[model samples]
Target chain A: MARASGEAVLTRAVRILAVFEPDRAEAGVAEIARLTGLHIATTSRLVAQLVELGLLSRLPSGRVGVGMRLWELGQRASPTLSLREAAMPFLEDLHAAIGHHVQLGVLDGTEVIFLERLSAPGSVVNFTRIAGRLPLHASSSGLVLLAHGSHDLQERVLASPLERLTPATVTDPRELRSLLARVRRDGVVITEGHIHPEATGAATPVRDRHGTVVAALGAVLPNDGRAGGVVAALRAAAHGIARAHTARTSDSH
Target chain B: MARASGEAVLTRAVRILAVFEPDRAEAGVAEIARLTGLHIATTSRLVAQLVELGLLSRLPSGRVGVGMRLWELGQRASPTLSLREAAMPFLEDLHAAIGHHVQLGVLDGTEVIFLERLSAPGSVVNFTRIAGRLPLHASSSGLVLLAHGSHDLQERVLASPLERLTPATVTDPRELRSLLARVRRDGVVITEGHIHPEATGAATPVRDRHGTVVAALGAVLPNDGRAGGVVAALRAAAHGIARAHTARTSDSH
Candidate 1:
């Protein structure tokens, strides 16, 4: 019974945390209770415990926000952080060369979650943010991931109703399937106005030592005649990142 | 009874999470159970629950590591993320100009925890990593924060035994107190061989709208005559980050 209750409490905690989105970083006990559908007293007790553990912090406004300890814990050992650290040098090089937005993304569920994004001032307007999600059928990074993902994942995405973000997003399953095939064959992808009319995304796969595609390295640039250069840069950076990641992981073992 | 058990579970969960440090990113259940001092059965049960919630993931090596979902949740709403986002562009600029290491750090307890670090290839050796911590009297960023910290915090740090990372590290409370006074007056701090012999750290305080110091922007470069240029660039970038942070927080409200 104690074990069951503990699991239930963890589920509740996760639910409460899920509500604190990028835009809404803090909330009161009552607001959290409402959002998580837990009793006010229970929410208060759990929140107090979380604050004591340094997983949540009390804000000046008498609300609570995610704590620095939580971020530290997540960053210290998250596999994503390892991948991100390995790719960051190459990402910076690509960012300097391309002079726009460079990102590293991985497939999460059916969406692509960006792990890191390096942007320059007055660069192309990009909708993607660090830790932001984009649809698999509607982003260059997403397309590359979807094309290389497992068959079950691909079928599940193709069977669902694809949300069209702009005129250029591949909404039709048939067209998206062909696009995936081409991306797999070419090992790179460029999507003009897929997410935004003013931006173009080009991505390539980053692989592990076993030749498994692990992440997507992409650049978002202006929708101009500059994609040819971007693709070559991305491919080279991806290879560099893959080599570095392999070296890093192997060194640890 | 349920509430008390739930809180205990959360504490245990945090203890388990805390064991995954930079050098040890993944661990077997038996190792975790031993490290956390929980029964093997309890640890296995809790780890299973954590995996179900996506807070931990199972690796092909049959070990558990910090999950990508945990990193996403931490990055999405942590207050540190806002400060990091605000300072990133300026940090990048400083990195490019300095051609070494640039970082943003905030006080966590008596230590300073780096929120972000931009490093270049073949740059000067830096001991600090993103999410890494350094003693308040042994790092330039830490000294700047310590100099501007509250009286209670200052007293606590002074009362404790100051760790000596290098021969030049400030160990005498009287000397450290004087150094703190100088940092507060000059609004910047430079430490030579405090943590490492071949590296120098220069930092300036980053403030919010109310003029309260919230972070320290610093650069780790070679302990050479180039310290003058780095100090000027760090001061400029710190001001830029402060202004950007104030603007971003105000715009949100």
Candidate 2:
């Protein structure tokens, strides 16, 4: 939608890229134009320019996907690289211990963006995917991050309408407030069937060197009493990740 | 460098982001200004704009680093995500078997950009970091990809001035040609001390469903004579990655 003659180039580029989502990673120019609400000619031209810059590439089906260059640039610019690296070993341990989905997620705005996730083919019907997002009020990782997030962020989320994903998703502002407080007090949260009818999410906060809660280490498992143990395992792994993160950051400094 | 009015806006934005590297991940406005060759005031304004967009964020020390949003955007668009996901299980297995730095890389332009790496703290002295880049001729992963790459790309690399990184780096055109030929024939490349004197890089090509060499799977280890076993492990892992990749692509189709 940034075809205005005087609009910033970066804004237009971001708009074009913003069209690609988890479910729709590749799209033809016509679909992209429709989704971005940009004129077909303008979208085509911008796409061409992006391809030239290696920010986008053509797929075998002639659809454009994010280019390797963007990935390289993101690799350089993505501030989460170190955090993800720090959390990887612990994530592996947690995955082996839990035998379900193990994920490391960071709070971005009011949502949790998963940086890494380890899963098996038939693991627990978990909705979490690497680079995917989930609402802070519903998902376990989101709950942990939001519990340790800024008051302003918490207030903003509370003020906004919490969209319901599944029937069990906690959407009431009052219920969510209490949930956030409990997550803070207990150092963990286990929400049952928020994303699916038969899955439960267990999460714990992961801190940085400065003791700032930087991420949420979490697991998605079948709804059962097993979440308590998963929470303990998650908390232990979170502690390890936080220690590793601190060590790496301090070393770099 | 693209500050000229009416120039591509994305180009200018890229220039600002291009200033950040693994070594220079966090930078002050003045340094970024110098690197991007933009006016100090202009750089600051653009930086502010990018920060507002969450493409960049200010660090605790008041310097700018890549924002989580950029990583998120990169995650969505980057073509390497599927490849990285497909290769992870095998990479972990290879790492456990070899106890060294295992990495997956893809050819971007003339360089090999590493997408993921698994390593222990005191593993081999690796110059390769996740999302880091190495010159095509100086890294084993690069050599494998280049060997299987197009004739045009091979010719272009040979024609270019190859900058030597270490004493073992092959810069001579005739020598490099033979090496590339050997890698194609042998289905693997073992480069010793091209990046660091104590490290040896052994790599093999990973194919997609259509049997296209889409990436290079490799490992960095001590420059001892024990490369044969590592090569065998790498080839097996590469085969696994290719199978997973093909399955994924065929599923998506």
Best prediction by DockQ: 1
Task: Please state the error at residue B201 of candidate 2 in Å.
Answer: 0.8
Candidate 2 shows a clash count of 1
**Model 1: clashing residue pairs?**
none
TM-score of each: 0.95, 0.95
True contacts kept of 2: 0.57
lDDT of 1 at A89: 81
State in Å the error of residue B48, model 1.
Answer: 0.4
The DockQ of predicted model 1 stands at 0.71
lDDT of 1 by residue, B144-248 (tens): 999999999999999999989889999999999999999999988889889999999999999989999999998888988568777788888989998888888
Candidate 2, superposed: residue stretches over 4 Å from native = A1-6, A60-62, B1-6, B60-62
User: Interface RMSD for each candidate model?
Assistant: 1.5, 2.0
How high is the CA lDDT of each candidate model? 0.90, 0.86
Among these predictions, the greatest lDDT belongs to 1
lDDT of 2 by residue, A131-250 (tens): 899889989999999999999999999999998988999899999999899999999999888888899999989998778999988898988767887767888899999889889889
